[model samples]
Target: MPKSPETLLEQEFGLIAELVHAHARARPRHPALIDECSRVDFGELDQRMDRVATSLQRDLVDVGDAIAICAAASVNYGVVFLGALRAGVAVAPLSPSSTAESLATMLADCRAKFLFLDEHVAKTMATVALPSGLQLVRLDHSPGVRSLEAWLAPAGSVPVPVTIEPDAAFNIIYSSGTTGTPKGIVQPHSMRWAHVRRARNFGYDNEAVTLCSTPLYSNTTLVSFFPAIAGGGTVVLMPKFEAGKFLELSQRYRVTHAMLVPVQYQRLMDREDFDRCDLSSYRMKFCTSAPFSAALKADILRRWPGGLIEYYGMTEGGGTCMLLAHQFPDKLHTVGQPVTGHDIRLIDEQGRPVPVGSIGEVVGRSAAMMKGYFNQPDKTAEAEWYDAEGKRFIRTGDVGRFDADGFLTLMDRRKDMIISGGFNIYPSDLEAVLFQHPAVRDGAVVGVPSREWGETPIAFVVLRPGATASADDIKQWTNSRLGKTQRLSAVELTTELPRNSIGKVLKRELRDRYAQASS
Candidate 1:
């Protein structure tokens, strides 16, 4: 690491707790968090996190034990996460938007003895079946749940200190298994440390103030959130996202940085008064976790002021690719080359290396790879690929071809591809044709089971505001432009598509609902 004299954070990368302590002492009054419910400065955040660590030890919680938290984004949410790190305990963050049964299953997967809940989560989960002898406490008051305040240690209480190593478990983030039960992806301290180190290139520092609207549990959000705090910068959190409000905060806080998904950019750009905001302070912005259209990238580059960079990687921490859209406008259609220290390559269905620039699945190896899926060694192994010399790589499940320039142009997810008349069809190709129409605002194509073709392409689209072009009109217009095998059998008009918490379109939900409705 390069030497810097800015703050202790530059030198305090061994454990996360030490960095928090350094920030608290160096700049006590620095605003560390701005959340929907409350704002906390560096000193108060450190003290509260210390209380949590001490409280856990007082309750006989041992180091390396897991603490489970299912809650909305808040200052308290940040407290629990930082505190667990302080006490050398791993935290399991469950998805709040998951079904009750699914949530219960994940809780069992992590095997946490104690579960923490936000007040709102307590009301809904109060009826869900949980393991016997597992204690549940709410962050704040709830009608029928125990409050966390009663369990917290005194303000001056100190936690027992322990040495932390690189390989110790940091947190378990569950995968969004669109097909079945989710698997817990175990990230270690070393992996997290690598993330912190990688962040330096993005310019996260004491002067930086990051705006994070997405949920804290999602790794999509954390890739940006953790870096700011680790660098002793303030993090502004939003409980929910609204375009007008997002711009308003950007103007009010002179927000220096943000990590938003592609959909949020679409909504912001779609606003009529988007250009009116005073956003000159923004130094950098990031997008990931969903398909970012080339057109949208061009539009944002034409309008938004900040440096826009898109990241392409899995939450499992395989090799990562970065597209600096601002610098490579000609390469807007492609996600940029692999990040440093990451070896990315293409492989065929049989795991054989494809020729350079050929379309194949993306597999990569990196220093930041996950420890493994918690307690699922076989499932963990299933996601890895071993090269000829036996170096391991993680499968990205997406098909793409690399250009001579080393930029990767994605075709479609392996599971999302359609086979019609024994020919492969990429939905993105069909969607690109659909987006060419002036009336088309946002579009997605899914392969639906068909009697004649085995599986056929079906398009769902949201039209531009005030546009009245019919679905049949779009279907005909798009089909005329696409190749025969990739043509959409039908186009459905909708106000909006189903999406998850992080703004990823829920195509599976659409397939299930529409397929049933048609049947």
Candidate 2:
């Protein structure tokens, strides 16, 4: 019999792939992964993983070498990721939505020996100059290409086992950089183990079913993905997010757990048939990645069926704060308290710790932090902060203050803070007021160059459908509710705001557009 989940996790460090294989031994017939096309049970899933590992070994891919995957989420993708882990290879999951250049840069940055992709991603990457000696394996069947099915070793193949240490590189998740090549964040096995162990508190077990709406490249998706398998649960992967499809699958699979960003929640709530969907099976719903508004939290609490949790932290693994929205309705504005064993503090511009209630840059230290930025020691050093006691913490680049009750209220990203007439302004504060306008469907605030104040705030408004609100009318109304320093210089009407795949408003894009228009 396989070891129990709790016993395996009780070790100093554990391998995710080993834990998954253990589950296969314990419950071979149980469903382990579900994608749009097929369902894979634990028994078959384990065999597939072994075949992938054995094939990599045959290719002479050594332990700790990296491989890259650039495809939509699918059963084969999951197997490749797990199999690489079993062979002690770190998987670099690249985003398909990234520009071809950016995608190529990431593949090169990780020093991958193989690039696993689907026909769709292959067409997009046709223009990319692939690194020399990098093998291409198609996840889907393509007549002329090397396919994953053909690449796999014979049935019953078993790879030579290897040890995975606490500090061994597990995966390299790249930052969402729009400009040059994004830096790869190297997360270790110990860090992922910490996430899996902490996930036990959220009720992941053999019976748990997790629905993942985000792409596999994102850490947002993996946080829930790894935990489900480690706990012997079933994971349902979506090719792309459609609110209606998500609701349908949630009810179809009786999904018990989910990790979603805030905008996804907004879309789900806005669906005309939302109230009709049977979401009563959800045990817990998680939100992260961007600022989750208090209003949205309350809306979900009033209408949604399960406990809602909002996590506040960075992908680099710093201090984390979690707000159990169901338990603290009155404290909806704050992002709850720092999680257990995470030391989160605020520091001024000069790196001094701020006073108890003062707003400063958020810095945190935790057992789950990343190893460092891959191949970029200087960039890694720039993201670190050492306390007076010489302990290291990752800088979160956010400005926030702690309330008397220890809850954190985020102000803004330190880089996003606008200086108007020598006074500081948080765009979130202005955006909150903009959201209050009845005719506003979506909005954002950005600072533009101004000769008078050095910089002045401008508003971008997406008016509600069929609403006859002019930019001037919205600006007048917004300014009427604001102080002199916070008033907008202009309000430009737009159909929608540009956002990244995970729903963070692309403020840099908005700022650049405004600058070019003014010029």
Candidate 3:
């Protein structure tokens, strides 16, 4: 008999593959993964994982070796990701949105022996020179290309099991940035285990149906993906997230849990047919990755079913804050309190802890923190801050203040803060004022170099459809509400703001655009 899910999770060092295999044996007929084209049961998933591991071993890919995958979300992608874990090999899931040059650089950075990608990514990478001797496996079937089915071992093949340490690399999630070579964050098995352990708190179980609409390469998707499987739940993967299609799949699968970013929720809420969809089966919904507005949270609470949760943290794994939005409607403006066992502290520039209710940089230490940046020790060191007592914490780069009730109110990124005539101006405060304008649909505030004030604020506004509002009209309305130091110098109208794959506004891109236009 296989060990129980509780037993495996409680172990000092447990492999994710072990838990998955146990579920396979205990409930062979239960659905484990569901994508658009296929539905895989735990038993079939287990056997396929074994075949993948065996094939990798046959290829001389030893334990601790890394492989790179760039593809759209699919059952095949999930199989390869889980199968590599079974073989004690780490996976680096690269973004298909990255430039061909970036893809080549990341493949080289992780020293991957195999590159598994789809036709789309293959076309993108056709011009880039890959490392010599690196094998290429096509995730989707293509004539003359090595397909995953061809690469996998025979169905009955069993892989040689290897012990996985708690600290071993599970996956390296490259940082989400719009430009430059992104650093690969080396997440360990232990960090993922922490997420799995916490999944129960959000009601994950065998009956749970989790809908994952985000790309598999993002950490936002994995945080919910691993837990659903570990708890023997079914996961529905969406290749592309269209608001209508997402609602259709949710009702079809009776999805109980979903992890989505704020923008996705915004789109869903804005849809006309959202209320008609059968979302009553939903037990819990999660939001993260970007700033979730208080108004949006309130709207969700009023109309959406089930409990709502908002998580605040980084992929690098430091401290985490959770806002049980349904329970604390009054605290919607805050990011809730520090999660249990997560040590979150506000520190000044000199590394001293800030006084009560004061704003400072957020740093946190937890059992789930990452090992470091892969092959970039100096960059990793720069991301870490050691306390006076010698405990290390990941620097969050966000400035925030804790209220008397312990909820954290984020101001802005420490680097994004505008210093005008020695007065600090938080863009969020300005953006909040801009959001109040009925004509403003979306907005972002950025700081640009100024001749008189050293640095001045500029507002980028996306107006509502059919709303007749000039740049000057919006600017005057917003400036009237903001403090003198926080007023915008100019306002620019745009169709949309640049955002990363995940929903963070690319402020650096906005600033650069401003400079180009001024020049």
Candidate 4:
């Protein structure tokens, strides 16, 4: 029988590096990771990590030190992550998609002495500003950057073992900067262990195969990435998101599990060959990082062969809610209840609990919560909420309400809420109505400055292919169905909605681009 999660946590073999070593011994030839460029088996992966750990020690990088990586997702990056973890070094995976200034800030914040950069990133940094004093090692050969192959320890070298406490710092995941400058959220080994443990409940095991298409830097992808390793399963990664490529990989690998954003799901289902692909091996489909619609969930359940689960939480790890769509078909519209040992509640603007079922800001505390923001106590304090009994919870910045059966139905982000004419309006409610229209492909609404009502919602929409619908036609049709205060001021058509690397719509960008006085 497999070890219980609690037992696994308490045991001496609980360390991720130790677990990788065990897998190396028992299943040396088993393919541990596969990417478009290459494949790594358990034994090879273990040895590579050892070399990385040894090299870090040789460079005088000690426990608690951070190492930064900015590159496209690949098999090489995975080995670097494991190698750093084994050396008791916290690995900070910086998003390559971030602007040069943002990248420099994050690199400086983490203070990573060693950096592993892919060729593309290195070239970009050369033209833009680059962090000084880093022992730069390129993922591939570059003119000025040292090759990663030349920096590794000897093939047979082994690293000295170091004690890793459960509370030891693991990784610093910087936020996506949805509002402004991103904050680095510090996640500990214990918090990550909880994620691995919780993953077993989703049926991850030795035979499982997880397909991850999103960028590795995002927490949305790691929710599945780490578990596949912990479960002793094969992980397939993609360098970038391409609908046709994703389908081919899923069918070729007989991928049994996936953690994708809603936008990804929408594209996959829209593919002409979606139904032709043999995805019978799939057992679970996990989603997070953005909203997942009930209508889309229903469509997947009808066509996709797997249990559909939606996770609602932030990277800061305060609290997470799960909606097991496969189990609660009737509650598809709700984001379901809290997972085991998670506490979720809604609070008014004053930080006081609101009446049950009334909409308010979502606050939660869980075993998987992050330690705090790195080196920013004031920012960390701002994110925290304390109850009368002095129990602590993290503010999710999302507004939602719970039903009689404990299912949560999210309204909008606290900052995203629009107050026009003394009434609060949620953009999600309006977005849902937009999706209902057959001609509407996808849409987003943002509050534009208004002289008459202070702030009114203006929408941007993408029409379905070959569907001819004027902006005025869509605006009139949608406005008629909305409540008096919730109507959109106007609708502007677009070819596509802007999204970040993790597929969350860039509403801030939309508002900035279309900044205009409302009628």
After best superposition, candidate 2 residue 190: deviation in angstroms? 0.7
Question: How much lDDT does each candidate structure score?
Answer: 0.81, 0.87, 0.88, 0.83
- lDDT string, candidate 1, 175-218, tens digits: 74111356789998877877887888887988998998877878
Q: Of the pair 1 and 2, which is ahead by TM-score?
A: 2
Model 2, which residues run further than 4 Å from truth? 416-519
Model 4 residue 381 lDDT score: 97
Candidate 4, clashing residue pairs?
none
Superior candidate under lDDT, 2 versus 4 = 2
Models sorted by lDDT, best on top: 3, 2, 4, 1
The estimated TM-scores of all candidates read 0.80, 0.82, 0.82, 0.80
Return the clash pairs for model 2, or none: none
How much is 365 displaced in model 1, in angstroms? 0.9
1-519 per-residue lDDT for model 3 (tens digits): 568877887776677899888889888999999998998999999999999999999999988899989999999999999999999999999877666766888888888989899998898778789987789999887555699998999989999988888899999988732234558899999999999998889889989999999889888899999999999999999988888999999999999999987767888898998888889999999988767789989999988899999999988999999999999999999999999999999999898999999999999999999999999899999999998899999998899999999999999776576655434456776787799899999999999876455578999999999999999999999877654456789999999999999999999899999999999
Q: Pairs clashing in candidate 1?
A: none
Candidate 3 Cα deviation (angstroms), residue 28:
0.5
